[model samples]
Target: MENKSEEKGITRRGFFQRILVGFGLIISAGATGAIASQLLKSLMPSGWFGEPYVYRKVYAAPITEINQVGASIIFEDKANNRKAILINNGGNIQAFSLVCTHLGCQVFWEKERGKFLCPCHTAVFAADGSVESGPPEKSLDQYPVEIKDGLVYISFREPTWQPEQYFRGEGL
Candidate 1:
C-alpha cells in the first residue's frame, strides 16, 4: 500500500471540524458545571438551629399578646440561661436567634415593618425567620418550638457554616 498519510493528511475541513467538536465539548462541560453548582447550592443547608429546649413558666403576659406586635422576649431556658427572642406571631410560634446571620448583629422585631430588622445592614426577616431583604443570602436558623401545658419550648441545633454529619441526621 502506498503511504496512507499522503491521502489522509489533515485538511482544513478536518481541522475546523475538530475545533468545532472541542468547542462543543467545552460548552457542554461548562453547562454541566453550572447545573451541578446550582443543585449543590439548593441541597446544602444554609444554617443549623440548635436542639429544642423548653421553658415552662407562667408569663406575665400571654405568649400571643407578647409576640403579637413583634417583641423580643428574653426567657430562661431549662438550664436557666438567658437566650434570644421567643416569638409567637398569630398562629405561628417560632424562636430565632437574635444574632444576625451575616455579622452577628442583633436582630429585633419591628412591628411597623412586620418583620425582624437588623440595624447593621437593614436586613429584614419575615415572622417565620426567612430573609425578606438585604445582604443575607440565607434564612435564619429556626428552632422547633412546641407549646405544652401552657408553656413555650424552643429547640435548635448550634449554628454551623460547614455542614456536619450530625446536622444531617446521619448520627442523629
Candidate 2:
C-alpha cells in the first residue's frame, strides 16, 4: 500500500520544515515592520521642542541683596529669559532653577517645612535640590554658587529659543 504523503512527494518531515519556514518568515516580516516604523517616526519634524540651554557662569545678584535666610528671592535673567531662586541659608548661598522637573510650574521654597514644594502636583524637593517625594522622577536642577568680592555668582544654563523659519517654501 502506497502512503498518500509519499505518493505526493511531501513527507511528514518536509511538511514540518515548511511550517517552520513560514513561521520564521512571518517573524522576520514583523521585525522588519517595527524597524521601519521607528525609522519613519525618527524622520518626522520635531515641533514645539525647544533647544537645550547653553550653560555658563553668570552673575545673579549681590551677596548682600539676599538679606533674609531660609527664604528665596526670585530673579530673572532678562538676557536669557530664565528664572531662578536665590537662597541664603544662614550665609550658605545656593541657587536653583524655579522650573519644576515634573512640570513647568515654578517650585516654591517652603520656609516652615524647610523644602521646596511644587504647588501644582504636590511635589517636594529637599533644600539641596534633591527629590524628596513626588511624581517627578528627577530632582530639580541646581545652579553652582560662588561669592566673589561681595558679589553673588551663579553658574546656570539658559535655553536659547529659535523661531521657526519657512524653508523650501514649506512650514508656511
Judged by lDDT, which candidate is best?
2
Give the total clashing residue pairs for model 2. 0
Q: Please write out the lDDT profile of model 1 over residues 1-172, one tens digit for every residue.
A: 3333456686666778899999999999999999998887777556234434443333322455454545556554444333556765665766766778888787877766668899999999887788889999888766666666566666644433424555667645
Q: What are the Cα lDDT values of the candidates?
A: 0.66, 0.78
Backbone collisions counted per model? 9, 0
Model 1 C-alpha lDDT versus the unseen true structure: 0.66
Clash-forming residue pairs, model 1: 49-156, 49-157, 50-156, 50-157, 51-155, 51-156, 51-157, 52-155, 53-154
Query: Where is model 1 more than 4 Å wrong at Cα?
Result: 1-82, 156-172
TM-score to native of every candidate shown: 0.47, 0.57
Tens digits of lDDT, candidate 2, 26-100: 999999999998887676444235566666777778767886777567778664566788887776788888788
